[model samples]
Target: MTFPVVGMVGGGQLARMTHEAGIPLGIRFKLLSDTPQDSAAQVVNEVVVGDYRDLDTLRAFARGCDVITFDHEHVPTEHLRALEADGIPVRPGPDALVHAQDKGVMRARLDAIGVPCPRHRIVADPADVAAFAAEGDGFPVVLKTVRGGYDGKGVWVVDSVEEAEAPFRAGVPVLAEEKVDFVRELAANVVRSPHGQAVAYPVVESQQVDGVCDTVIAPAPDLDESLALHAEEMALRIAKELDVVGHLAVELFQTRDGRVLVNELAMRPHNSGHWTMDGAVTSQFANHVRAVLDLPLGDPRPRAPWTVMVNVLGGDYPDMYSAYLHCMARDPQLKIHMYGKDVKPGRKVGHVNTYGDHLDDVLERARHAAGYLRGTITE
Candidate 1:
């Protein structure tokens, strides 16, 4: 039997992990990376080092692949459309992917679909930002670049028009949104196939630090049963509506009034769903591969009552390998996943997952292991 080759753009850790997931299914992957040092390029046997922004590079990479997908959404939308025009299958095609690539487009689409989201609009200038603020709760409005922003970059919380000037200086469209007074952040992860089959993972609480994901707790604690179901249903509905034939993570904000509003959308395996590596019956990466290949979806059920995933950020320690003995000895059940990248302060190097019946224990184990790996915790 001839197995299909999946072409993934962007060789970040997401691509690396997704490649790993496909290994078990005898699925081959071809990666397009910015450089040979990129995370996935270092692991994927077949890699083409080139820029995703160039149409020719993309065309060259897609030639022998059965289907194309992504690890990140930064690829130019027009390039993806061109690929689709050439008879290449781009899962989460340009039309559906634009929502993930541009914040303004996403908000507009969500609004048209009657999907609850933060009040938002495109701000032409700092004055328009102030006007947007005045229309809502006033001042402290959130400004984000319409495209090319992630992990808190290109996003700003401005208290006044002067503070909002920087976003407009970039020469990119800016979107102003009412700053939501959310009690906590939640993520609803779902996977869908071209055949319309879908699966939703348990709603997970996502904790962010400095605009980057820091930790994720699966089956968000004390979540009302009905609200959890609503989150799952909403995520599934979004995947179907957008014609996303892969993983879709709906980043949500649980307002103080118990309402959930959509914050962001990720059309790939997301950090919030990383806990599934050891916690779920089917990891998001595996399901993503299956979805893109149009195969039957897998179960998304949790294997344990509580599972916690903590990101391992790079720190002063350059050699994290030295600390593995201590972390492994401390908690034998901890699962560590590290990207083969050099350590740099504040860079995401890897993550740790811990699952058990006790939430507190699970949380502590995951945090400690991640901290130890990052040189934040000793003894």
Candidate 2:
């Protein structure tokens, strides 16, 4: 009758939500947080304030955990290897996690597998960037830091060589890519177990504002059935190819010509799948725990015909709790999840999920609640 213990490195909101999912299953969730105030540290009973980059700290945290996973991918890869050498299980091992950690590696690997992606190159210097732009789409290219970039921080739309210098300041290799002429962005999420069992959730349409996710809608609007299936297949194929256990999120771009191109990869419960918490038959967090533990996965079916999730960004109004009464009174269907974090402008402090049989109604409900919480919408 011993319940398995799962240790998650990094104490962000993802770990917080994963802890909530583990509670019902009676599984133990341990946190290796950088600070006592980190999102999950405030709630989880077992919290270890340690730097994930330190191999000694990581080894100490994994002492009794059955499996080690992550809330973020910034951990030193060699530290993960050290844990594996100690006979501890690391779901989506360092080999698989590297592709998500380094954009350059991700692109090269995807290209080798013939996954549809925009043309890209690893530039040694700014001049190499210019050469890539000259040979490819020419000017207005996207430049990204090969490692350690998230949200909108490390991405740049460079129309000229001068515009690309900022990204190189981090001393990381720069990845130059053709700026995709996409009509919209999409995401396909899947989970795989160690036994090779996997499940793909319905494709979702993700909206971004300044490179940060703003909202997500399940079963993307106007998506052709064939194209949706293709995206799912591509995501599932990638999980198998990389031997990725736990969750895998494939960010994609839908071109004007109706083709879907791979955009990015996240080997954890992603913002795009946040709608699953209340909209699907089983939440992504629950399945992530099951997958990493090598248990049978829960069904990925949607409970409602349409589900829309809107991110609540921190704004001038710091006390979002005040708006809760109005949001719930107006729409009891709204499910609001507020992370335990300080309010900072443009920070993702929480999100709202709305589900129903009608798409437009659910979309409006989710958006309005999120907007109200951010103080962008009055009444």
Candidate 3:
């Protein structure tokens, strides 16, 4: 039997982590990296150095692969279509990926599909933003660049027309939405296979700081069981509707009125599902590979009653080696996954996962370890 070689585009930590998952399954991962120093390139043995933006570069890199997938959503749709036309399998194909590529398109499709979502519109200018805001509570609207945004960038919670200028400066259509009075953020993660098989993981509560994910609590504490199942169903419906054949992370906003509204969608493995690396029966990285390859999926059930994942944002401390040693000595059970990235302030360099029957204990262990890695927690 010939093992299918999967070629992943992008050189970030996501690709690096996915390559790790492919190891045990005897899967060969080929990567197209922007630079030889890129995170995935450093570890993935088959590294093709090229820019994904150039059609020629992408064409050459995809030639020998059994299938191609992405570590990011930035690849141009036309290029993917070109590859698809040549009989190259592109998991979560370009048609479905476009929704994740552009916020406006995602919102429009979600509305059309009857998925619960926030009231949003594509506004031409800041004045148009105010016009939409007026239809609601007025002012303090959320503005986002229609495309090319992630990790807290390209998003603005504008309290006034002047505050909305930043997103407009991006020179892309701005998506204006009513500022949701959300109780907390949640993520419903699901994986779908090319054969139409699918599975949903437990809904997770995600906490953000300046729009970047900081911590995640799996099986969000005391979340209404019916609502939890509804979130999962919505995610599954979305995958089927969009023809998404890989991991889909639906970021949600649970409002003060207790309704779950779709906030964002990610076509690839997302930060919100990182808890699954150690907490679940199968990690998102592994499922993404299996899904893209049309293999039978692994289980999504959690290994424990509660799992807490806390991101280790880069701080002044660059000595992760020292921190890791200390954290390992302190909580031997803690599972820390480092990205092999250079430390930079506020960048997600790694994460720590801890699972236990007690929520507080699990959260503390994960948080303390992550904080220590960031050199924030002492004693």
Candidate 4:
């Protein structure tokens, strides 16, 4: 039987990239976005403009599609449950998606499952933070809102009681976690199908600036073979335990002592795995679509010895086209993917990926090309 259409809830860059993947599978991607200005709307044929919370809008957008999934984890669990009640197939259903939506719940669940995570608590008020810091062994813990936190927003580092008052007054519950002293951060991207088939990509090291990811290096240079296997095994274990279908991205921290700790979870295609687009035999976007549709998963083999991806943060760049030309002129192997959004300071406007031998050289070349794209470097 021929496959049916796939409906995506958010039309951000993830959906945009997924649309590119679905095209080759002969599967149509119909997106429900807020406006035509959304990143995916520019490239896809079926773009529905509406609010994600509106059932009428969702019902309209979901018409005739065999399966419904998300580019983001923001869709309310109630909304997804409602669709399931009406016989709509929701990949990585509400049960699994909830683990990504609420950090408090996720931490609690993972702790019960024996996953190693940072010391954390659900704080009702800022005073709880002060007491925790005073009573606990660690000071200056990380404060994160239980929900709606992303890209460094809704997160804070509090060293003293004075730093906790704002959240207390705002009536927002928070998760106070002991700050981890780690050597580096890494992410493992794993995908699963409804039939229990799973595949894991190479563990990638992420470079961060102010808690935002700036670049990713696949297979994490100089990483031990044992560590790579452990990362992949942990990711697969989480996926099976959570019964996660579609994609599950586990962000981990390698502590100073060389142990890996789970930091965060994402149930969609993630920024950390963008290098898979050009570096892997099958891109993550493609695998996610296949998983949601219950199609056979593809191999997650790397295309070359190394792959480096650098994020393009928006800055004061006048002629981005000229910068693009410069990158192509200097390094013809670089593949650039830019979201069609107006540039602003610190926003992720695009990314550039380079795949070849020599991990260090690939990373340096990618960073230099990205600097040009950001108008930060002349050559």
Residue 63, model 1: lDDT of 98
Off-target runs (Cα >4 Å) in candidate 1 are: none
**Candidate ranking (lDDT, best to worst):** 1, 2, 3, 4
In Å, residue 126's CA in model 3 sits off its true spot by 1.8
Residue 219 local lDDT, model 4: 81
User: Where does candidate 3 stray beyond 4 Å?
Assistant: none
- Clash list (residue pairs), candidate 4: none
lDDT of 2: 0.94
Query: Residue 163 of model 3: what lDDT?
Result: 81
TM-score of predicted structure 2: 0.99
- Residue 44 error for model 4, in Å? 0.6
Q: For residues 1-379, write the lDDT of model 1, one tens digit per residue.
A: 6899999999999999999999999988999999999999999999999999999999999999999999999888899989999999999899989999999989998898889999999989988998999998899999999899999999999999899899988799999999999999999999999999999999999999999999999999999999999999999989988898899999999999999999999999999999999999999999999999999988999999999999999999999999999998989898999999999999998999999999999999999899889988887
- Please give me the total number of clashing residue pairs in predicted model 1: 0
Query: Over the stretch 33-146, how does candidate 4's per-residue lDDT look in tens digits?
Result: 988999998998988889999887788777788899998999889889888887889999999999999999899989989989988889877678887787677578789988
Quality of model 1 by C-alpha lDDT: 0.94
In order, candidate lDDTs are 0.94, 0.94, 0.93, 0.90
TM-score of each: 0.99, 0.99, 0.99, 0.98
Pairs that collide, model 3: none
Per-residue lDDT for 201-302 in model 2, tens only? 999999999899998999898899999999999999999999999999999999999899999999999999999999998899999999999999999999
RMSD score of candidate 4 (Å): 1.2
